[model samples]
Target: MEGLELTAFQIISAVGTARSCYIEAIQEAKKGNYEAAEQLIKDGDEAFVEGHDAHSGLLQKEAAGEGEHIGLLILHAEDQLMSAEGFKTIALEFIDVYKRFDAEKKEA
Candidate 1:
């Protein structure tokens, strides 16, 4: 496969894993496992950075007028990246709400 193909694969793998991590974080928070939830969020961020970097590289390539011809797989990768980004935002908000609930429970 070509370098662009490899990069797209890497982005897909990393962002998919990040999405899973973000979901796991929300699940953990729902269970009141705030520590684990926070850890998962952190882990997700790390994975997201890796994926984001790969995506940015492609953008940079395009900016430099070196973009590979577009492909369906690359489009799929971009879709996954957007999904991951949205998931991360939702995960953070969910975690925050869970934390507040946990705090209220502790006080009650």
Candidate 2:
């Protein structure tokens, strides 16, 4: 973990954690814990930013004609980043649905 390997792993770990947080947030919302769910979403956003920043470095290098050495690890890292992004959207939607359910229950 000294160069591309290091950056790639960092991206993978950060985004992976973000993805978990997003999923957990949805679970929390389902449990009617809106506060905790919101906090998890915030945490996930922070982790996502870190991963995106790391990936940006690689993009910058490529833009400068010094693209990443191109390896399976890096590709996997990119995949994780995309997955995390998708999870964020899904989590938000799930949370909203949960909130609506809670509201309806209260009204009932």
Candidate 3:
């Protein structure tokens, strides 16, 4: 794998890691480990940025008229990237909900 193929794999790997981190973050929040959950969110964001950067490179190439044929691999990578982004949003909301629940419990 070279060039576009290699870049697609990079995006897949980075976003895959981000997706896992976001899921794990939600689990941590469920267990009342807010700090760990927050750290995982940070980690996820870092991984997501790496993937986004790789994807952006492809976009820039296309804009510059250097576009290659988009293949199933690239499509899969984009799918994973979108999934990871969605997970990050869900994780943040879950963390907030968990924190609010914890606070309410404390008050009660």
Off by over 4 Å in 1: none
Tens digit of per-residue lDDT, candidate 2, span 1-108: 598999999999999999999999999999999999999999999999999999999999989998858999999999999999999999999999999988999999
How far off is model 2, as Cα RMSD?
A: 0.8
Model 1 lDDT per residue over 1-108, tens place: 768899999999999999999999999999999899999989999998999999999999999999999898889999999999999999999999999988998999
- The sequence of per-residue lDDT tens digits that candidate 3 reaches over residues 1-108 is 799999999999999999999999999999999999999999999999999999999999999999999999999999999999999999999999999999999999
Q: What is the TM-score of candidate 3?
A: 0.98
Top model by lDDT, which number? Answer: 3
- Between candidates 2 and 3, the TM-score winner: 3
Full candidate order by TM-score, most accurate first: 3, 2, 1
Q: What overall lDDT goes with each candidate model? A: 0.94, 0.96, 0.98
Q: Give the CA lDDT, 0 to 100, for residue 21 in model 2.
A: 99
Q: What is the lDDT of candidate 2?
A: 0.96
